[model samples]
Target: MSSKARHSLDPLNLDRFNHEALIPLVSPLTGKNYIGWCNHIELLLTATVKLDFITGKCERPTERAKAEQWDLVDSMVRSLILGSVSKEIAQHFIHAKTAKSLWEEIKGRYGSHGPLLYRIHRKLRSIRQGNADLFEYYSKLCNLWSELHYLKPIPVCKCKCNVGKEISVGECNGCILAKQIADDKSETELFQFLMGLNDCYDNVRDLILLMEPLPTPSKAYSMLLGVETMRELSKGEKGCEKTHDLVCSYCKKIGHTHEGCFKLHPKTKRSM
Candidate 1:
């Protein structure tokens, strides 16, 4: 028996399922801002699918009795999809008869186009790690790289060449295409990452570039991280030294002197 067969026999109440519990508030897509909205809708739809609810193309039910059940589940799924969206975004798909139609309608209206790609690249080009956490900076770049990757999926190797050898004697279209695209992307991302680093990392960055074979982005990140970690450790050590150097005349504490000691004058206005 299928999993759906068991699910149908011991049916949970779909009506009792709180659709709003996990669904995020998807901001209305003004054509430009829809990727995140689409992601939210996809997750919600996947949840419904797991519950044996169909959200795809409107298919006719084999039995007359099942038609009614289909319509009810379809409506529920559609409502879940539309509820998270704004009125403006919802209005465009108001006429869609099925959940699938509604989903496709929204994707067709906002998912494609050059403007979105242009904006993504523009943001990538302008990103800077100034006064920001290094991990956060790397993560932001990685997210943008992921978004770009989704736009253009990585090609896979299909040729049956020497599988274990370093050089494939017969590199097919898939392998060549994948390698070319990966090389270009890696170079571009490395340059972007290097550009975003602060002046403090200039010497280290230059050294990486001057190497016999320049390091990969991941390697560059490791080198930068090592520098950042050491810098933070040095700063912490200096802070500890400063703390130890302090001497309060009241209780002789390491953090404060007599003028800043709260114990020296507990009731005085100058007490800290």
Candidate 2:
């Protein structure tokens, strides 16, 4: 006989068969009969296991079905609870909420420095003043804040004019420009006076170019040569004689010269 024929009659293999494996063997049987057999086998095995575990009083098939259904429902509930707890733990570290709180947290972690605090203060001040353009004020504030931090004091350059008497540090450019524009002065005198000021060479050149009646090429060339020569002469122990002589004769100051004068110190009366 064939192996299939032998197995069909073999009760040992059929008794050990599970529902999945029994399907192939029972394929020749009607679907209703196969399903009845599966249900009967499952109920008998479940009852026998339960009876062994308990006092030989097996649980009914209806009770076993209810218990299995309840177990699936309990597992689903447990999975949902664990998923919620994991989400909550993740949210504790990664906040998807407002940026303000996050920024504060970062600032707290890394100590806020002077420059950063000054920038924030300036921004707040600009907001309070209703000046929406914060960038315009930022550069000025930063420059001043840095100077203050470094303890580098700015020098005040005095102007001969009455209006420029109350000069403050960082006002040299404007003072020279103003002196150059007034129609009363000659171009040569203005150029020479500007050279005497502590303003940078570029600033002097720019101011000269911006004058109402722009200086002639000859005047510009002369001014350039004069500034270069003065720069060279001032480097050594002795100062430029031409520049020193002009300042000494014309400048109101006695001990020093106009180039060194903060302002026209009050003219001293001669004592008899």
Candidate 3:
């Protein structure tokens, strides 16, 4: 067999499969779209970990066998990574020999912790539920939160407390930091969401803030939603009321019967 043909048959040669056959097509990760695209690719790579493609774990192997397996896994990962990106980006890293090198190249060019944090903060500030659907507004905020979490993952406390006894809730350093962050974020998020609210909600928002323990972000959302619903209901009731309340031209009073109206019945006319 030809050397080229033999390489195609190798178990790790992902290129042999049609691009769509191995992994679904996703949009290229341009600098502008890097955050969401990176998130999606990261999840795909995580799932692929179980197949021994990520870390290339081999329990036992001879010197040459292990090396070949690692090379095969790297080839597969590189192919998948290149396949998912735009041709322009792919061309830039076309010569990259390993998945790790390509990954680092992309991260170096596009990912910067400082700028990402600033952008996230700006997004959080500008976001408002506004005329948009409530669920969509909440989902957009959630996506931002997820990206922020990825950029700065919360640390887990590993120290044992009370010598094997399970640590009580809220006692760990991680929990304290997480709660503080959440509390701070909640204040900003609640205000952003409130600012976008219709003017009719001004009173409701004021009332919410005045409460002893101001509502959590989720509770505030619920209260605002309820207020919106009631406003809609009140508007509908007023419309119905307008239709039912009929004032007599002559009697100048509502619910005036024909028998009581001097204009309609001259015989029942009264002095001016």
Clashes of each: 0, 0, 0
TM-score computed on alpha carbons, candidate 3: 0.65
lDDT of 3: 0.63
Query: Ten consecutive residues with minimal summed lDDT in candidate 1?
Result: 238-247
For TM-score, the strongest prediction is: 1
Measured against the true structure, the TM-scores of the candidates, in listed sequence, are 0.65, 0.17, 0.65
Displacement of residue 95 (Cα, Å) in model 1 is 3.3
Task: Please give the CA lDDT of all the candidate structures.
Answer: 0.65, 0.37, 0.63
Full candidate order by lDDT, most accurate first: 1, 3, 2
Model 2 lDDT tens row, 1-272: 99976755432222332433323332221221222232333343343221111122322235775656534433332232222223433244244222223223333433235554565445434432123222333334444334333332233345444344533323468565544443233453344433433333344456466766877534654654564455556555233333433222244322344544445434342221
Looking at candidate 2, the ten consecutive residues that score lowest on lDDT are 50-59
Model 3 regions more than 4 Å off = 1-22, 50-62, 161-168, 172-174, 229-272
lDDT, residue 196, model 3:
64
**TM-score of candidate 2 versus the correct structure, residues matched by position:** 0.17
| TM-score of candidate 1 to 2 decimals | 0.65
Model 1 / residue 19 / CA error / Å: 3.5
Q: How well does candidate 1 score on lDDT at residue 249?
A: 47
